[model samples]
Target chain A: MNDSTQTAVQHRDYAGAKLGMWLFLFTEILLFGGLFLVYSVYRSMYPEDFHEAAAGLSVVLGTVNTVILLTSSLTMALAISALQRGNTRQSVLLQGATIVLGLVFLVNKYFEWSGHIHEGIFPNAPELLARSHGQVQFYGLYYVMTGLHGLHVVAGLALIGIMLSLTIRQRITREDNGKLENAGLYWHLVDLIWIYLFPLFYLIT
Target chain B: MNEQDNHIVTTKTFAAVWIALLMLTAITVSVAKMHLGAFSAFTAIAIASAKAGLVLWYFMHLKYEKRLLKFLLLVPILTLAVIIGLTFVDVWYR
Candidate 1:
């Protein structure tokens, strides 16, 4: 059942492109999957503590990032469409739009994390001296999962920037834009991770 | 995935997607302030899932893609579902 877009394709870079993307995606899933497994086990182990710790996160920041990510996904879709129609310029613009939005997301995330730390909500030292003191590990997990994902966003932005440069130079054309398309796939995977993360990290009871 | 099918989209499609994303953002944020019991989580996830599907069908071109790729997507999801089931089986007992 490994029949992703990869499809053992040989003789052309299309197969390689899709296959490379799928492999990258698998690695991403594994990365986040490990986190999810940890979270699930810990959540079930200390449900009350996790809830209290989770309540400390800012829903407003999470919501903003979610919107930023959703808009990025939309632009990415349009970029692929532009590429399909041989409109490399428009495609590049759309890709650029996605990159800017991603940067904005990361900037917002930086401020959010800093705010949390300023409040002494660090996993090592939470400020509120309540029964929720033991929930520091949950904060620890939150930082780790979202931090890894933030790194992915930064990487995705870099990939898109390179792709935009390639497109501008007319190197990526309608026939062989597979690399750009696959790059878009990488961005989508980042978006998908947040989709699950938003609910898992922010919406927990 | 259209592959010589000329299933190219118009700027109008992108515009529509922008509008949808804005609406989804608004709704997702507005829902956060509501108290809907367990359904609060479900509502947020439902919206997120819809957003994913929209990206896949339009952005990923799954709608115009070959059947092979379509089925390929299900493999990973199916596998994940099975894994989740197994995890719950173990966790529920412990």
Candidate 2:
């Protein structure tokens, strides 16, 4: 078949598109998985310092953020369902809620990080540097992992924003809701990573 | 498209999963406060894994996906397990 003919035939294969997204998500999983491996190795090596450092973190704040993310995931799922059911207005409202929830999570993160920084607890702060090597590693990993996760949250917001616009424009209809579904998948992956991160960083100690 | 392929998860199911996850979070946090030694870590991770499973299966629609897609999802996780296990060997010996 000619190239143009083949392209036309391959268009609108929702399963194929979803498969491509899943493959991309696998790469993302591996990316974070490598970091988790490093975390485990370090935790094993400096068990005491890791525990002590983790104890300084605010479990209340962590739990609150966890709830926020979980709620956002629910809204995201509902948004996709709304889109699939041809309820564009409701879908947009749910998407807005998800985005607002995501922002709230980020705001809480900001305050949390600032609190740590104010207390000289940042990765490279003089206070942190003066701490034991294990403490230093603990803070370093904490910042890096959570920072990366924050970036994912920002990216998810942008993607959802685009989906919102697409929905408004009727580009993403009930029959062509794959993009919205894919966006939900990405958002869930972000939430999924945090599920592991919350326990690893905050609770395990 | 097949009806099953386009299955829509109910809001009730999502709410139930959210409640279960929150309850698990509370349990893990309470478990953390008790000095359970190594078991504390195990319990926390186990709870987190359950929460993640619910999110993956329900929120991410992996349960509604085709069998092949579901298997494909496991490939990366299995690969990571092997990688982590090998790394542990080095850490254990040293």
Candidate 3:
């Protein structure tokens, strides 16, 4: 919303933050969308290879991460709401909870990627775990896409931390909480990306 | 906030969404396991697109966003979808 058009503009820092995040998310989707387009085209050309590669991924880990990220999203939404309701204590608490959950996702990713690496399943790692060259390429793209996404998660965590500090320092109030909402929005986009990535990368067909 | 305005989500809503997502996950995985002949590609991506829509609606809060913001967010996806369609039209058919 423009400056004059908003009634609570002065206190709605989160609104502009979310708008910027949505724009950034647009670029990110373009980046990942390009890779996905490549994957989709290749999946059409060589279906079995993609299926076999996807099958090797750990479903349990992916599901766990999904739940974790989803929980974080819930906590994040609640965090902003807490501030809105003028409950700073609950706001800080929920925000901290959200950060921890976000870390859990990264830690899970670390082990998950390392498992593939240990098995010599990475892109440049020549010998696959009894798979094809295309299969290797699939995992390679999976790593690239997810790994980059993991980095974003970390960056998002940093942003969350900043927002958390603001909350503690009394910079963030219910009236001026657009920053928190924007951070939450970006975080949700990350979760949204993973929801698809989970099925796409871990569930083979 | 009125009692109605304080409409915290009920447990049922969360449970329902989770169940749907898990069911969708199971369906996608099982469908992948089955060799659906030539339709496999179409079916898998179709399922994924549906799941993506679900996530966009609930998790991304598109349903709660400003109408203009919603339109702005969609512009990119629509653009990308068109570009993807054009690429397939030119490359896949020929």
- List ranges where model 2 is wrong by over 4 Å: A1-10, B1-4
Q: How would the docking of model 2 be graded? A: medium
Best-fitting candidate, scored by DockQ = 2
Per-residue CA lDDT of model 1 for A1-205, tens digit only, reads: 2245655533455655675677667667777877877777777677678766778788878878888897898788788778878888888889899999999999999998999888877666636444453476688788899999999999999998999999888877786677787888889889888977886677666
Candidate 2: DockQ?
0.57
Cα lDDT tens digits, model 1, B1-94, are: 4355446767787678767866875776677667565566678778877877777776666676667777777776666667777887898886
User: Model 3: per-residue lDDT, tens digit, A1-205?
Assistant: 2434544444334455667888888998888788777777777666778877887788889878877887787778778767877889998998999999999999999899888789887776657745676786787779888988898899889999999999999987765666776788788778777766876787665
Worst lDDT 10-window in candidate 3 chain A:
A3-12
lDDT of 3 at A87: 88
Clashes of each: 0, 0, 8
Better of 1 and 2 by TM-score: 2
lDDT of 2 by residue, B1-94 (tens): 4323799888888889889989998999998999798888889889999999999999999988889998998899999999999999988996
Chain A of model 1 scored by TM-score: 0.89
Preferred candidate (TM-score higher): 2 or 3: 2
**Cα error of candidate 3 at position A42, Å:** 1.4
What would the per-residue lDDT of candidate 3 be over residues B4-91, giving only the tens digit for each residue? Answer: 2223333455456656766776677678668776676567677767766766666566676678777897788898898888888876
Ranking by lDDT: 2, 1, 3
